[model samples]
Target: MPVLDLTDLPAACPPGTAWLGLDLGEKTIGVAASDTSRMIASPLTLIRKTKFTDDAQALFRLMDERKVSALIVGLPLNMDGSEGPRAQSCRAFARNLDRIRPVNVAFQDERLSTSAVERFLIEDLDLNRKRRAGVIDRTAAAWILQGALDRLRP
Candidate 1:
C-alpha cells in the first residue's frame, strides 16, 4: 500500500476495517475515525507535535488498536483550490507515514473545515472560545472524514 488517490481509497480498503482521518497542524495532529461500516466518523484524539518518529508511532498504535485499514488526511487547500505550504506539509507527512505503515492514505480538501466546525460549536453546541479551541481540530477532522465517507457511500 501507498499514498493513494481519493478515488481509489474505497476499493483499496477491506470491508469492515475503519478509516482514520487526520488534520495535520503545526502544533498538533487532530484525529478521527470512521465506523467499521464506514457510515459515520467521530473525533478521536489530538496528538501533540513532537518528533516525526514519535508522531508516527502514536498514529500507528492507534491504527493497530482501532483496526484502521486506511487513512484520509485533511489537505489544507487554499480557498482558490491551490496547494499551499500547509498542503505540501500534509502530503509530506502522509508520504512518510506511507513509508512506515504501507497503508492506503488519501487527502481530502479541508478548506474551511476548521471554521465550519467552529460555527457548529458556537451556534449549535454553544461552546465557548476556549472550549472550542481545545477540540476544534479533532472535530474538524471528523467533519472532513464525514465528507469523504458521504462521497464513498453507495
Candidate 2:
C-alpha cells in the first residue's frame, strides 16, 4: 500500500496484526517479526540478496507465513542525520516494494544499530566475529523494530 512514517504504524497495523522489521543491506536482508500484540520483536531470518524481484518475493513469502501486514525497514542515515546513498537506496527499495505488494511500510533511523548489536554480541555474549556475523543482521533488525515498538507503547 503506502509508505508510512513511524508515527503512522499503529494506525496502519492495528492490534493483533504482526509486522516485519527489515534491515536491508547490499548483500543480505535481515528480518524480524513482532508478536501479534505488537509488544515483542524477535529475529526471524536472513535473506541473501540475489535479484530485486527475488528479494521481494522472499520478503513477501515471509510476510505471508507470519500474517504480517506492515514493514518497518531500517534506514541507514548518516550520523549527522543526512540521507546518504544508503538511505536513498532504502527509500527506493520501500517504494519499489510497495508498488508490487500490499503491505504498509515505514523506516526507522538505524544509526549505529548494527554497531550496537555487534557490541552486544561481543562484550555481553562473547561471540567471535564469525558468530557475530551470523546473527548480527537479524539482531539489528530486532533492535530497529524494538525501537519503533517502544515508541508505540503508551
Q: What tens-digit string does per-residue lDDT give for candidate 1 at 48-148? A: 99999999999999999999999899999999999989999999998888787787899899999998999999999999999998999999999999999
State the lDDT of candidate 2 residue by residue for 18-110, as single tens digits.
Answer: 998999998999999999998999999999999999999999999989889799999999999999999999999999998887779989999
Q: Which stretches of candidate 1 lie over 4 Å from their true place?
A: none
Q: What is the clash count of model 2?
A: 0
RMSD per candidate (Å) reads 0.9, 0.8
Model 2 ranges off by over 4 Å:
none
Task: Give residue 93's error in model 1 in angstroms.
Answer: 0.3
lDDT of 1 at 97: 82
